[model samples]
Target chain A: MISQLFFLLLTSVAIYVFAKNLAKIRRNILLGKDIQLNDNKAKRWQTMIKVAFGQSKMAVRPVPFILHLIVYVGFVLINIEVLEILIDGLFGTHRVLSFLGPVYHMAIGFFEILAFGVLVACILFLARRYILKIARFQSPELSGKPNKDAATILLVEIILMAALLTMNAADQLLQSRGAEHYINAGAFPISSWLAAPLFVSFNNDTLVLIERASWWFHIIGIFAFMNYLPFSKHFHIIMAFPNTFYSNLKAKGELNNMASVTQEVKLMLDPTTSTPEGYAPPTSFGVKDVQDLTWKNLLDAYTCTECGRCTSSCPQNITGKLLSPRKIVMDVRDRLEEVGKNIDANNGSFADDGKNLHSYISEEELWACNTCNACVEACPININPMEIIVEMRRYKVMEQSSAPTSLNNMFNNLENNQAPWQFSPMDRANWTLEG
Target chain B: MSDFRVKTMAEVAASGEEAEILFWVGCAGSFDERAQKITKAIAKILHHAGIKFAILGTEEACTGDPAKRAGNEFLFQMMAMQNITTLNMYGIKKIVTGCPHCFNTLKNEYPELGGNYEVLHHTTLINQLLQTGKLSIRGGAFKGQRITYHDSCYLGRANDIYEAPREIIEKLDAALVEMKRSRTNGLCCGAGGAQMFKDAENGKKEVNLERADDMLETQPKVVAAACPFCMTMLRDGVKHHNKEHEIEVKDLAELVANAMEL
Candidate 1:
C-alpha cells in the first residue's frame, strides 16, 4: 500500500511537470504570424501517417536508418508493457493483466525480445556517436548541448532496458521458488536465457528485493524520460507529426506572395483605386525575428531533429559555404526559447533584448543559400529551412533595400527595361533575327 | 532561322486568329547569346510540329522570378502583373517556356495573382511530342553516345520534372549516365535564387565547380540540360575545369532539334 501511494505521487508529479512544459512549448510555437493550415484535412492526415508514423523519409541512410527502425519499433511495442506496468504500479498487483492468460504470456515474451533489440540498437547509436564518431554528429553545429542531449536520450533508454531485463530475471527466480505474490503468468524469452546468469545464486528474499527495486527504477526512469523530451532534441519525436501535417503544400519553387504588398502594388499600377476600409499597412516586410515568421516556420524549427542530412546534401554547405541549413532551424528555436523565457520573466510579455534572429544568423550565411530545397527533401520529416531563408532575404531587400551590389544592379535593370539585364524590351525579338 | 517566320501575339490577334500556345521567351532566351540557341531550337520544333504558337514580342516583360527570389516582392509583383495583363489580353490558354525559372513563375506563382494557364517546360513538351507520335526522334548523330543530364533546380527539385528530361534523352538513343547526385538529390548549378546575377558569397569553392565535379565523374561525351540558366552555368562549369573542348553542353531542345529527321 505504501509503495502504491509513493508510485502515484511520483507519476502525478512527472505528468504534471510534462504537461506544464508542453503548454509552454505550445505557447512558444504559437508566437508567430497566424496562417491557416487546416485546408485539405484528408491530405494532411495522410502526410502525418506516411511521414511521422510510417517513418518513410528516414530511409536515406540505409545502415543507421535500419538500426533506427529497430529502436523505433521496439520502443513503441514495449509501451504496451509500459501500460501494464502503469496499472500494476497503481493497483499494487503483480502482473495484473496476467488474467489474459496465454495471450498475456505471448505478449510479454514478445516485449522481452523487443527490449533486447532496443538495447542493441541504442548501443550501436551510442557507438556511432562516441566510438565510430559519425561525421554528421561531429559537425560544429552539434558541438555543445545538442551532442550531450543526443547521448543522454540514448543512455537513458539503454539503462531503462537494462532495468527491465534485470527485473524479469529476478522475477523468474521468485516464480521458481513459489514466493508469495509472484505470478508465474507471463513468459520471458530474453531475461529467461540472457539475464539468468546474474541471478542463479540469489535466495528467494534477495531475489524479491531485487525484483521490487528494478520495478520501481524502471517506471521512475520512464517517467523522467517522458518529462525530459521537451528540453532535448528528442522533442522531434512528438513535433514531427504536427509539422508534417501542416506542410507547405506549394511547389518548392513558389515564393509566397505578400497579399498586403499586392494591394499596394495595384495602387501603384493605377494610382486611382481608393484603399479598402479595413486596409492596414504591413508593419514590416518579411521576417526580422521569430514572431515575424509564420506558425509553420516555428513548427518546422521545433521539429528539426538536428540530423545533418540537410547540411550534407546542401550545395552551398558541400562547397564549404558558411550556411548550414540545420543551423538555421536551430537558431530559430534558440531565439524562440530566449523570447519565451523573456516573456516569462516579464509577466507574460517580451522585453526588447536588443537582438533578433539576425543577431545569431549572419547576412553572409543568409546570402549563401541557393534555395535549392535539397534540405527540405533530405529531412526525415518535412522541415523547410529555405522558407526561413527566403523570408529573411525579403526583410533584407524590401524592408531595408539592402540587397547585394550586383543584385541591386539586376533589380535596377529589372525596373528600367523589364529584364534582369540592361537590354531593350523593344529588341526582345532580336533572337528571331539571329541566324 | 531565316527560313522560319515567328508570329507575334499582336499579329495573331489582329489577324482574328487564335494560336494554341504562347511561347514565353524569357529574359535570358531574349538577350543571352547561349539561351537564344535553345529558344530557336524550340521555335523550330513548334513550327515543324505544326503547332500554332505565338510570342508576346515586346509586350512580354520579365516574369519576375529573380526579383521574387531575391526578396523584392513589390518589384516581382509589378513584373508579374505587367506580363499577366499582356497574356490576358491575348487570351492565351496554354504556354511553353525554355527557361525553367520563367516556367516555374508562370506556372506556379502567377496563378494566385489571377494569371492562369496551362504551362509546360520545353522538355516536357518535347517528351510529350515524342510519346504521342506528333514527333518522332531519329538518333542520327547522337546514337549510343554516352550523355548525362544536369537537373536544373527550378525544373527537377523545384517542379518535379525529372523523368521528362531523362525520357527525351532515351529517345535520342544516348546512354544516360547519372551522377551520384541526380534527380531529387541533384546538386544546384549555382544559378538558382538569383545567385547567377550576383557573385557567390564567400565559400571554399564556387557552387558550379562542385557541380562540375559531379559531371566529371560521369565522363560523358555530352551534358544535356533543360533550363537556360543551367546551360550557362554548366557551360561555365565545364570551362572552369578546362574540359570545355572535350565535354559538350547541349540543351534538350538543341539535342532534339539536331537529331530530328525534320
Candidate 2:
C-alpha cells in the first residue's frame, strides 16, 4: 500500500509538471507568432488523416519502421497491464484483469505476445544504434556525452519487462491457480518455461509474495519512466506528434512577411533590442539567433531525435558543403537550453552579453545553404529546416549587413539598372533582335 | 522613335490590318541583328498566311522578370506598372512573342501587378496557323538533317507549355531528339533567374554547359530552342565548348521558316 501510494504521488506530480511546461512552451510559441504562417483550413483534415494517424514517415525507412511499430503498439496497450498491476499491488487482489469478458482476456493475451515481440525488437534496435551505428539512427555530435545514459536506461526497460513477464508466468503456472485466472495463458513462452521450475521450490505463499513484488516493480517502473522523461532525450516521444502536426505547410521559398515597423513602435518596444537613440525599432527581417528564432524553431530543435535523416538527404551536405540542416536544429536546441538555464538562474540576465550566441553555429554554416527545401521535405517528422535557415539569413543580411562579396556587386548592379547583370536597360532587347 | 509606330494586337486584329499577327518584336528582336532574322522570317510566314499584325517596336520595355526574380520586388512593381500603362495605351490584347521569358512574365508574373493580356508563344501561333490550313509550306523539306529541341525552363516548367512546341517540331521534317533532362524537369540554360546578368557561382560549372553536353549526346545537326535567352546561352555554350562546328543552334521559328522554304 505504501509503495503503491508513493508511486501514484510521484507519477501525478511528474505528469502535472510536464503538462504545465508543455503548455508554457506552446504559449511562448504562440506569443512569437509561429502559428500565423500555417493556413490550416485547406489541408488540416487531410494532414490529420494522413500524418497523425497514418504513420507515413515511418514507412520511409523500413528497418526502424517494423521495430518501432511493434514497440509503440506494445507501449500503448501495456497501459491496461499497468493498471492491473497497480490495482493488485495496492489491494492484494489477484486476477485484476479478469473483470473483462472472455474476448478481453484474448485481447490481453494477444498483447502479451506483442510485448515479447517488442522486447526482441528493442534488442535489434540496440544493436542497430550501438554496434552497427547505422548512420541515420545515431545521435548528433555531443560534447562529453555520458554514453551510459541511453544504454543503461534501455537495458533497464527491457530487463524490467522481462522480469515482470517471468513473475506473471510463474504465478499462473505453480500457484495451483485455476483456469479462470489464466488471463495470459498461451502467451509469454520463455516465462512459462521458467515458471514450472520456480514452483518446485516456492510454496503458494512464497509465490504470492513474489508475484506481488513483480506487480509493484512493474507499476514503479512505469512511474519512473514518466518522471525521467522530461530530462531525457526520449522526451521526443511525448512532443514529436504535436510538433509534426503543426509543422509548416507553405510554398518552399515563401517567407512569412514580418510585422510592419510602425506596428512594433505602437506596441511598446521590446527591451532585447532597445537602443540609446530612443527605441531600437524592430527591423522586419530574418532570424539571427535563438531569441530571434520563433518558438516553432525552438520546438523543432527540441523535437529532433538527432535522426540525421535530413543531413543524409541534403544535396549541399552530400556535396561537401559545410551546412547540415540537422545540426542547425540540434545546435539551436542545445543553445536554447543552455541560455534558458542561465535566464532561469539570473532572473533573465544576459549570458556573457550574448558573446556565446554563435558558439554552436558558424557564419560558414549559415552561408553554405542553397535554400533547397529537400531537407525539410525529407524530414519524416515534418520540421521546416528552410524556415529557420532563411530567418538566420534575414538577420545576417539586415542586421549584420554581412553577405557574400559576390552579392555586393550584384546588389549594386540591381540598384543601378534593376537587373543583377551590369548591362544597360537598352541591352535587354539585344537577345530578341539576335533571334 | 515616334515614327516607328508600335501597333497593339487589338488595332491589328480588329481593324483587319495587312499583318495577321502582332509580332511583339521584343527588345532583343529590334537591337540584335541575328534575332532580327527570326522576327523577319516569322513576319514573312504570317504574310504568306495573309494574316495582319504589327510589331510594338521600341514601345516594349524589359518584361521585369530580371527585377522580380532578383529580390527587387519594388523595381519589378515599377516596371510592370510602366508596361501596363504602355500596353493599355496601345489597346493591346493578344500578344505573340518569340521570347519565352517575356511570354512567362507577361502571362504569369504580370497579372500579379494587374497586367492581364492573352500572350502566346510564336511556335504555338505558327503551329495553329499551319494546322488551320491558313498557311502552306512551299515545296522544300530538308529531310536529312537531324534536329533536337531544348525545352526552355520558363516555357516548360514555369508555364507548363510543352505540347505546342513539340507539335510544331513534328510538323516540320525535323527529328526532335530530347536531352537527358527535358520538359518540366529541364535544367536552366543558366540564363533565367536573371543569371544572364551575373557570372555563375564560383566553382560551379555553368548550368548551360551541362545542358549543352546533353544536347551533344543526341548528335543532332541543329539544336533548337524557343526562348531567345535560351538560344543565346545554348549558342554560347556550344561555341565555348568548341562544339559549334559540330552542331548549329537555331530558334524554332528559324527552323520552321527554313522548312517553309522562306
Candidate 3:
C-alpha cells in the first residue's frame, strides 16, 4: 500500500509538470502565425512520410542513427514494460506483458536484446563525443565545467538496465530448478542462460526479494529519465513529433518579412504591450536574446539532439566559416534556460538585454550563409536555421540600413542607375550590335 | 503622364491593328546593330512565313529587370507599368522578343505590375516556323562546323526552355555538341541580374570566362547562344582566352538567319 502511494504521488507530480510545459509550448506555437505561412498538401504529406517515419535525415549519419532508432523505438515499447514493473513493485505481479501468452516470453527476449544494443550505442556515442571527438560535436566552452552529472545519468541508466535483466534471468533459473513456473520460458534463452550461474545457490524467498528490488529500481530509473527529459538534449524524444507536425510548410527558400521599423518602436514604447506577449513587435525582431525567438524556434532549440548532423553537412561550417548551425541552436537553448531562470526570478529581461542581435551572431556568420537549405534539410527534428538567419538579415537591411560592403556598391548602382551594372539602359543594346 | 507612355496592352495593340504579333525589339535589339540585324533576320523569317508583326521602337523603355533584381522595387514597378501601357496600345497580346531577358521580364515579371502578355522568345517562334514548313534552313552556310549551345540563365534556368533553341540548332545542320553544364545547370554569362553593368567581382575571374572554358573543352568550332547578352560575353571571353581563331559566337537568330540565305 505504501509503495503504491509513493509511486502514484511521484508519477502524478511529474505528469503535471510535463503537461504544463507542453501546454505552454503548444500555446506559443499557435500564436507564432507560422501555420498560415504556406500551403502544399502533397509536399506536407510526403515530408511527414520521409522525415517523421523514414528518418531520412538521421540516416544520413548512419552509425549513431541506427543506434538511436533502436533505442528510441525500444524506449517507446518499454513504456508498457515499465508500467508492468511499477505495477509489480506495488502489487507484486508482472501483469503488463500478461496479454501476449507465449509471445510475452518473446517480448521479454526482444527487450533484453534492444537494451543491450542501446547500451553499446550509448557507449559509442559517448566515445564519439569524448574520444574520437568529432570537431563539430565538441563544445570548446564545456572544458572547464563539471560534466560528471552527464556521465552519472548515463551510468545509472546502464546499471538499472543491468539489474532488471539480471533479476529476470535469476527468476527464470529458479523456475528451471523445480521452482513455481509463473510464466512460460519459450523465448527468453539468454536470460535463462545468464541465470544458470546463480540459480542453484538462491532460495525462492531470496529470488522474489531480488526481483522486487530490481523492479523498483527500474521503475524509479525510468521515471527519473522522464523528469530529466525537458532539461536535456534528449528532450527531442518527446518534442520531435510535435515539432515535425507543426513545422513551417512554406516554400523552402521563402523568408518572412520583418516588422516595419515604425511598428517596432511603437510596441517598445507602449507599456501595455511591452511584456513579451505573443508575436508583438519590439517584443523582438532579431534574436538579441532567447526570449526574442518565436515559440517554435524555442521548441527547436530544445529539440536538437546535438547529433552534429547539421554542422557536419553545413557548407559554410565545412568551408571554415564561424557559422556552426548546431552551435547556433544550442546557444539559443543555453540562453533560453538562462533567461528563463531570470524571468522566474522576476529579473524581466535577458542577460545581454540591450545588445544588438549582430553582436550575438558574428558578421562572418551572417555573410558566410550560402542560404543552402542543407542545414534545415539535415535536421531530423525540423529546426530551420535559415528562417532565423534571414529574419536577422531583414532587420539589418530594413531597420539598420546595414549590409555587406560587396553588396553596398550593388545596392548603390541599383539606386542610381536602376541596375546592378554601371552601364545605362541605352548601352544594354550594345550586345545586340555584335550578335 | 500620357506622354510618359501609353496605358495597357489594348491601347498599344490598337495602334497597330494590322499586325497579329508585336515584336518587342527589346533595348538590346533596337540599338545594338548586330542584335538589330538578328531582329531584322527574325522579321524576314516572319515576312517569309507571312506572319504579320510590328516592332515597338524607341517607345520601349527597359523592362526594369536590372532595377528589380538590384532590389529597387519602386523603380521597377514604374517601368513595368509604363511598358505594359505601351504594349497594350498596340493591341499586342501575342508578342515575340529577340532578347531572352526582355522576354522573361515581359512574360514573368510584368504581370506583377498589371501588364500581362503572351510573350515568346524568338527561338520558340522560329522553331515553330521551321516545323510547320513555313521556314526552311539551307544548312549549306555553316556546313560541317560543330557548334555547342550556351543556355542563357534567364531563358534556361528561370524558365525551363532548353529544347526549342537546341532543336533550331540541330535543324541548321551545324553538328550540335553538348556542354557538360548545358541546360538548367548552364553557367551564367556574367551578364544577367545586371552584373553586366558592374565591374566583375574582385578576386573572381569573370563568370563568362568559366562558361567559355566549359564550351572550349567540348572543342566546338562555334558557340551558339540564344540570348544577345550571352553572345557578347562568350565572344569577349573567347577572345581573351585566345580561342578566337578556333571559336566564334552566334545568336540562334543569326545562325538561323545565316542558314536562311538559301
Best by lDDT: 1
In TM-score terms, candidate 2 sits at: 0.67
Model 1 DockQ vs. reference: 0.84
Give the per-residue lDDT digits (tens) of candidate 1, residues B184-224: 89999998888989888777999888999999999999999
Q: What is candidate 1's local distance difference test score? A: 0.90
**Per-residue alpha-carbon lDDT of candidate 1 for residues A1-435, written as tens digits (9 for 90 to 100):** 898899899989999999999999999989999998999999999999998999998876898888888888888888888898999999988999899999999998888888999899999999988999887777788988999999899999999999999999999888888899997888998998998778989888889889989998999999999999998889888898999999877788888889989998999999997899998877789999999999899988888889888998899988888899999999999999999999999999999999999898898988888888899889889999999999999999988888899999999999999999999889999888867
lDDT of each: 0.90, 0.64, 0.65
Residue B46 C-alpha lDDT in model 3: 71
Q: How do these models rank on lDDT, best leading?
A: 1, 3, 2
Residue-by-residue lDDT tens digits, candidate 3, B1-262: 1112212234445664466787777655655555566666776667667777666554567776654443333345556666677777665678888888888778876664457789899999999999999888774687777999988766775566889998988787778899876664456676764455544434235557777788989999888988777778888889988988988788888788778861
Which one is best on DockQ?
1
- Per-structure clash totals for the candidates: 0, 21, 23
Interface RMSD over true interface Cα atoms for each candidate: 0.9, 6.8, 8.6
**What are the per-residue Cα lDDT tens digits for candidate 2 across B145-259?**
7788887766764566778888877777667788765664355576654556545544345557777788889898988888777878898889988988889888878877787
Question: Residue A299 of candidate 2: its Cα lDDT?
Answer: 76
Candidate 2: misplaced stretches above 4 Å? A27-31, A37-42, A83-95, A137-164, A174-190, A193-214, A259-284, A348-352, A356-359, B1-262
Q: Candidate 2: deviation at residue B158, Å?
A: 11
* TM-score (all chains, Cα) for each model: 0.98, 0.67, 0.65
Worst 10 residues of 2 chain A by lDDT: A261-270
What ranges in model 3 sit over 4 Å off?
A20-46, A138-160, A178-186, A194-206, A257-292, A347-352, A355-359, B1-262
